[model samples]
Target: MYLAIATDGVELQQPERTNELYASYWERLGPDEITKLLAEHDAGELLPDFNHVMVPVATLRRLAAGRVPEGWDDDFAAMLAHAREKGWLSEDGEAVRAHLERER
Candidate 1:
């Protein structure tokens, strides 16, 4: 599952097939503003597994075009809990960490 912040709104897309992930990756590119905003970060943060980025939940909410999909609420909460335990969250718990796969 992935959250896409597009020109219209945020879309939660789940590919049926594993190879579909590649198609979804570049189907519709996000606005340059997204990269511009990310580039503003001077000190990059990393999690154990990947080049992780710590983004404020508030920011994600603001960028969100819609509510979380049904049945995903608990999963989202669990994700946060796991991040917190892994020290992937911010000191104040205002931001959550996400993997930075690559520059598009």
Candidate 2:
């Protein structure tokens, strides 16, 4: 699944006024990385890094279909909620940024 990692304390507005302030670091996690993420999450090691992780809605759906990795519980839920509330989640939950007016 793909994610759009965001930078903190940054805001760049687009003409459409969609608040495209957050610069996204697009990533598609391999199995090993996904495993590590789950491990870190379970161990409470991901709190400091949680804000950077912006799981797309599609990825969220994929995760829902597959069983959540063992040990991912309240913490994961909280982060997902935060991502959604913070507008980090992509509209369709896909990492498509072609329409965003990125700052070069």
Candidate 3:
């Protein structure tokens, strides 16, 4: 089950039986037997690659806290240009001005 501990000090747990299958499978195999089996299969590529670009959770929290880093203005300008090219932003001056004001 998925679990989450919120920053506001709330603890949450998923009430589900998804882990039952895994529990039964492990029980039937026994811990030591499964350990041996895993050791034998360790020579083969059994896991998928998890290579991915990601920002740190802490860094995201800091950014959300309005702690803008150096060069943020340049980055934001570039992002705005890209968004404009993608037609996500309105072309009118008043709309653009209002959007920028709300962002700050």
Candidate 4:
């Protein structure tokens, strides 16, 4: 999932918004593997004026409100554990680090 951090605010970005998406990173998750951007990709520094912002992990869960299958709890938990180990979670352990990817 990708969260776009625009000049106005942070929100979940649609896949079609390919360019100028001041937002987060992407993940290629598989049964035994997960790949995502590096921590350096956290793009709050590229923000024009607002403070460094991060997309809350809670939001990610929200996105799963009606999309995931009936048995994804374990997978979700594993993802969270991985995020924690990488120090990608916010101090409260609620947000995930994002990246800056725009059309340059």
Candidate 5:
């Protein structure tokens, strides 16, 4: 399971779909743990596990353009770098809808 966060909101998701959202490291979390994380996010707490949150390419672009929430844990650069390293990012750092491209 992974926590998917975007400009819309957060959700607990299985990391299967490529273009659905950005996925983080695999962790078998219980429902209670998921709820706690969501609650913490709603309460504006900088998630201690913020690094586990993956920002989609679209959201990343918005973030770079100052169009999204700015209260993140200042891990944008690290996340972006990780994305690039993992081939989850486009050449220009924008959205890539195809999983094949993502794997390339």
Candidate 6:
């Protein structure tokens, strides 16, 4: 959720906006690095500007099919937790699944 803060004459308020902002970061980093990056972001130390994030279909398929790379399960679990926390999973999971199935 994107919080729009408005200040008017000594009053700071958050305005309700119809649009929400969401972002994701995916890279080829090792598991430890990925965990560190997610930790930094979760601690509000990093802010990335992104909208709809996607992984390569092939990679996603492999992941969904239980063929993860070495040490990827933990990273994937963290990603899932993040997505669920942001409410993006409910909104996008079906579409992503469909896309992956189609790519098979």
**Estimated TM-score per prediction?**
0.48, 0.25, 0.28, 0.49, 0.29, 0.28
lDDT of each: 0.45, 0.35, 0.27, 0.46, 0.40, 0.31
Candidate of highest TM-score? 4
TM-score-wise, the better of 4 and 5 is: 4
Task: Give candidates' CA RMSD values in order.
Answer: 7.4, 14.5, 20.9, 12.0, 13.2, 17.7
**Candidate 5 segments whose C-alpha is farther than 4 A from its true place:** 1-73, 96-104
lDDT of 2 by residue, 1-104 (tens): 22222222121222122222232333444434533653443211122333333323343334344454444445445544565576654575443222221223
Clashes of each: 0, 3, 0, 0, 0, 0
Residue clash pairs of candidate 4 = none
| Candidate 5 residue pairs that clash | none
Per-residue lDDT over 1-104 for candidate 4, one digit per residue giving the tens place of the 0 to 100 score: 46543333344544222221225423322212111221233322322322224555666566446665665566666666776777755688777655545333
Candidate 1 ranges beyond 4 A from true positions: 1-35, 39-50, 65-67
Regions of model 2 farther than 4 Å from truth = 1-71, 93-104
**2 or 4, which is superior by lDDT?**
4
Residue 86, candidate 2: C-alpha displacement in angstroms = 0.9
Q: Which pairs of residues collide in candidate 6?
A: none
Candidate 1: tens digits of C-alpha lDDT, residues 5-70: 333443335512111111112334433534433444321223345344555655544443255455
Where does candidate 6 stray beyond 4 Å? 1-59, 63-68, 91-104
* Better-scoring candidate (lDDT), 3 or 6: 6
